[model samples]
Target: MMEDTIAAYSGGTLPGAIGICRISGPQAFALADDLFFPTKGGKMSQGPFYTMRYGQVRAGDGRALDLCLACCYPGPSSYTGEDLLEIFCHGSQAVVACILERAMELGARPAQAGEFTKRAFLAGKLDLTGVEAVADLIESQSAAAAKNAASLLQGGISRPIRQMREKIFQQLTHFYAVCDYPDEDLDPFVNEEARKVLEECTAELDKLYQGFQRGRVLKEGLPVTILGRPNVGKSSLLNSLAGYERAIVTDEAGTTRDVVTESVRCGDTVLRLSDTAGLRETSSQAEKMGIDKARESARESRLVLCVFDGSSPLTEEDRQVMETAQGLERAAILNKWDKGALDFPEMEQAFPKVFRLSAKTGEGVSELCQWLAGMTQGEGETLVTSARQAALLGKAAESCRMAAQSAAMGFTADAFLADGEEAVRLLDEVLGDAVSEDIVHGIFSRFCVGK
Candidate 1:
């Protein structure tokens, strides 16, 4: 059978000024020529590669379907390393459907989710890391996440892995050569040099592994749970941070009965803010369950925003909330500062980070947002955003450490050599040098159609 030509709508679905339908495969250009007739009266196949032509897409009966623009990208230079064509048409579902149907009739099949990117991977245009980065870039919600994904797509993580693999391979090659020569004037593999190289590689791998903690937060917002007694402006605070009324705020006590979550961008950081029911003892069964859930959320959160009603005198309930937040990574927010302050020396002593703010007036919230952003900021560090990459890096680091330990203990060359080889193998998997088909499919499966 002839190679299947794939087609899909690649642009946003909403009614916009324009929409894009992309086609790729060996027959992509031929299919475009069959459907798109240039207004200047020429076939699209005769158009220069990478050039867009004003055209009217037609049906099989030569009926004008839509006035559109068409662009062609020849094979080996296209995104999928195949002849690719893109039709820029009116952003209407009817127009998109008609174009897709015409392309199908001309021998184009619908592209599967991530099939375009998967083909790019198979064509040697992108590694597995790069392919994952493409997915991340599409799904990124914050500037930090997009920046990190773009860096990974540009080989920020793969370059270091490739370098480490090369170093291990060099050491292995020298060891093998020395063993084969016996006395043929090849310099012996120096145990000290091998140990140094392995130690360096192990340290680098450990750094990348450590980066996952911050990387995960950058990619998928930092989990922050708001804790405070009823009527202390917890919901108002959540709305203030989110810049919208995500939670209903009223003067009524215990108004929030469940955890309300919203993700908001603060500088480069994305905060997954959970506004839980005010922590308080209640006779109502539902309120009691919500209170229990509040505590559970606090425990699972990476950071806690402990809100205090600065207008009211410290109560036993306030003390209990503060006590619950003790020993966790927390910051105190003295809310309702507009109402006037009350002395709370205990809060000052318990929490190192405290912000006095009025959620109603939007006062002093910028400082808290800045602090949250600073928590995950780093300078030019390679982040391991994928769990698979983190696991492989952990294994590679362990193997390097074992190799270094073997060399330091004066074990035979074979002992350290085996560990070094294992390290190289793990690094290979990290860079898609040697990975299973299932893993590759799983990674690409997360992508959307037309990527």
Candidate 2:
């Protein structure tokens, strides 16, 4: 690799105090030396490998800049296979800017956003799926999501994809052998044997396919709306899940006139619960908009919680509300259990997945958690949660389908072979064995600079 790439990355952005200002390439150590001007103990930068040198930072001038730490990483086994230099500086914006400015002055260029990780991938230190996992780990909101991302980052996702691609390519070669040399002699085409191999490949891939649905939900949580008439304990439910009063709770009806969203973990799944205003025919202009938003959230949810005041008798208002939530994966909540039920008895029959509990008292919340957990069990292990990966895999599946059909059609071996080779190439695309520059740019562009 040319040092010009380093020249191209003249000066990079700093993300703040916690982030390291890294300069990786052939001149990493030299760049560090040029940028560093210590104001403290003498000869600290001359330490052994894996040692941190504590000192004051400096600008182009010999003047002290900020107190900083410089850590060195060398060669082939490093995260980015290039010689890497990490300057740990005071997280202040001014300190970061001065160090970066000085580095560029000394011929050390700034690293691009995710450039280190990209370099790692290019150097064969990581696979495509592993690269995606780094992004996921950064974006993960919940513990479970972080764990899933970590698993993928550790190559839990890529190992399987690699294995599957290898098997499919091997089968592809065999398929081509059959297609190219028919009964005339070079190779014998055994339909049963070939079908068995093809079927097994498809079967294993399909198992991974089945996991995508659950994985998609985990990666992007299922939108579950918590809705009901005003004063039906919607805010109470929100507070309980958020573990604090995120939404204002009041005895007054219509206190919450807009949708309030909070995300919580139910076992391994992240549930985005939207607590919305009570649905009703309101004359007030503001209330009407709130009601509209509430309805919209409910309609968009993968699941809905229709709450009713179990302590109060069922009214026509409740019936109207329940009717609106039909045809969804729904659970009915009989809130205010502490107050005791009145003459209203239609809740159990109206919505079958009825939960008799009090959000205020925190009863029966366990059952709700268990149900939501079951909804997304075994989803984290899937490889296709990423939309980009799924789209590519789907394309590979279509190419496979084309090859299968061409094989069955009794087409000339040359034509059939073209289809088979194309299918293999598409599979390579899915595995990222061959990637377009557009894809590389699209994925890495989303990353923040100085990654």
Candidate 3:
């Protein structure tokens, strides 16, 4: 356990209904006794460790700060596995400042960023994956994001990693025993069984690594580019999807001279929509720069929405739009459907997934939204959202593949043993077992001070 006691304002913004001051360490209870006086006239350190008591919180000079409730939790049972105290008081900023000042005066230092959670980690209350999940849960913006983060916090990824590590360790143990003692009646190390185990672990790790991109889409939103010529209603489509007038719509062609971005939530999925300038030959330098950016956005995005005006006959510019979006994952959006549709044989061949929507009336937008939401469709499976976890998993999978190859080729035990051991070491780092202190500090540095 840490030697010095630490305290911080665990409650978020102050000046509201309630505020919480958290203290944890060896001197937590002693500091509580000095700062709070119970209404019924008994010390909290005496009995009823987990119960809260009505009290008056006082400053360093014995001046009453506020009337509130205080609770004490003894060591090995609290959140940090240390004696902890919590003071629930009014949310006034002045009151909280005085209480914190008094805490510092009484030998409790101010807590650092994520110190409380780091303490829990060091005390064995949480593993590395759980530590990361705590941060993920706090930063989750949607219900789908929160659900996945909650599953990670509940050991959805760590459990399988631990099981795979155990299985590899067992295989290593059997090989070592068979080589060390030739006279014993132990079961022989069969190459086929060992190869199967390694292959299974490799496949599982690959699956997890593959899901990282989808998890990123869930957490960071999918990138989408709107591509079309001037006067094609691309900006209108952007405004319709955003449910607001995000981009200015005008009857004049080439009104939008730059890319306008807005994050639109289509059901559970979030699309980072970019309404780029219309693609056309222009003399203006600014419009030319915008067209270049539009093409760049199409190259970088996962999906491109190629738009065309359905009320007018297809022009050469429309054919250029299709050619620009060639070899890309794209869909056709025929805008101004309320005005009436036109038949285009080439458009039908260019885009298999086509949607005819009237951006002015918001008709047929829901179908497009539903299609975008289903693009990232691994809902119930475990996903690795952190880049660190995904990189380690990929390396571990490669190591397991090498080990499986050695086993299948009937190589000597030591040949595959080196790769197997490296795989376990990488897996341990993923679990925060063999990680460096610098990495640990870097991971927790992203957390808020109160956490």
Q: Which consecutive 10 residues in model 1 have the weakest lDDT in total?
A: 180-189
Worst 10 residues of 2 by lDDT: 4-13
Error (Å) of candidate 1 at residue 447 is 0.8
Tens digits of per-residue lDDT, candidate 3, 192-260, equal 888999999999999999999998887778899999999889999999999999999999889988889
lDDT of 1 at 46: 78
Higher-scoring candidate on lDDT, 1 or 2: 1
Per-residue C-alpha lDDT of model 2 across residues 164-261, encoded as one tens digit per residue = 66665665666566555676422335433334444555565566566666667777787899888889898898887767888999998888888989
**Clash count for each candidate, listed in order shown:** 0, 1, 1
Off by over 4 Å in 3: 178-189
lDDT of 1: 0.89
* Candidate order, lDDT descending: 3, 1, 2
CA lDDT of each candidate? 0.89, 0.71, 0.90
Q: Where does model 2 exceed 4 Å of error? A: 2-19, 36-57, 64-68, 178-190, 342-352, 379-383, 401-419
Structure candidate 2, residue pairs in collision: 17-91
> TM-score of every model?
0.95, 0.84, 0.91
Give the alpha carbon lDDT tens digit for every residue of 113-146 in model 1: 9999988888889988898889889989887789
Which 10 consecutive residues of model 3 have the lowest summed lDDT?
Answer: 181-190
TM-score order, best first, reads 1, 3, 2
